[model samples]
Target: MPHARTAPALSLPIQDARERLRVLIRDLAVVRGRVVLSSGAEADHYVDLRRITLHHEAAPLVGRVMLDLLQREGLVPGIEAVGGLTLGADPVATSILHASAADPALASLNAFVVRKANKAHGLQRRIEGPEVAGRRVVAVEDTSTTGGSVLTACEALSQAGADIAAVAVIVHRADASRAAVEAAGHRYLAAYDISELEI
Candidate 1:
């Protein structure tokens, strides 16, 4: 028989965890240089948050910080699941799921993945993991530029009968992204903005 895995202990206080995550993101994820963004726009720097989101140390911190953010913003109570479009949001959603396991109040929180397209075979499901029907969910992403990706996830979630509580991200790169999400009628929450990253 296989042994049951345990949730990792929440070691740092939320404030400490958030600060540590900020430093890690600043040091590891911010790439300073001319680059084209996913929206095909040119920028002087790029925030490739996957570097920290998928990191061993930083990933846990991400969970802690993000969970705290949701709690502080009062978005956690009825949020049954967290996720966004696949790829960028994959590790972020998983991190939140793992972190929630360490907290009694949030242990019921689940994670889901929004596939770019429905699986051709099997159940032909567009959203993977636990069922999200009729449950309130928060969409998560590592970074948002135009909010297109997260919005896409929200659309699929709505189609599947899930109520979108809000959209959250580790970094908010453009003000336009926030506007776009709000224009779509969902609250936008970001743990850090580019100014805080000092890039």
Candidate 2:
């Protein structure tokens, strides 16, 4: 008779990711409130992703979370770079960059950013920092209500001949933004969504 095959032992309970995300949000104080989105419309809730992403403790956590997500999907494709829109994407991109620094497989991931508008002088480059042409990149942002900034950055990166692998957000507003990303055919990963983080 053939030997029976058994599944590998698990280390934790199900819904572990969701529960951890909720606790992190609550601990970081990501909350709901009236605010304007990148699309210039009033919103019932706002996720000040900086409240978490900028924290000394939160930064590493964000990195681990993103790395875990990619790992779970069995997607370990290396990124030639990581970046997004200027202000909102700053911290999240930095977190990815810092995390990559500690991992030998990801240490080559360069950091870059897109300007809201061209400088009109000097280099006049929309993309600043390491060259991104012909590279696979991961874009990150703080919050997305309409997904304008993320799209804009993607467009610029594409125009520069880049392959956008995925996008990561600190908090997903769970509105039209998700649809926008799906429409563009890129995987979207969020640390927390509005309903999940609401008080």
The number of the candidate with the highest lDDT is 1
Cα lDDT tens digits, model 2, 15-83, are: 453465456567665545787765889867656667777765555666656655555654455666778
Look at candidate 2 and give me any clashing residue pairs: none
Provide the lDDT at 102 for model 2.
64
Q: What is the lDDT of residue 111 in candidate 2?
A: 78
lDDT of 1 by residue, 33-123 (tens): 9999989999988999999988878898888889889999998766899998999999999999888887886646899999999999999
The segments of candidate 2 whose C-alpha lies over 4 angstroms from its true place after superposition are 1-22, 105-107
**Best candidate, TM-score:** 1
C-alpha-based local distance difference test score of model 1: 0.90
RMSD of 1: 4.9
Error in Å for residue 118 of model 2: 2.0
What is the C-alpha local distance difference test score of each model?
Answer: 0.90, 0.72
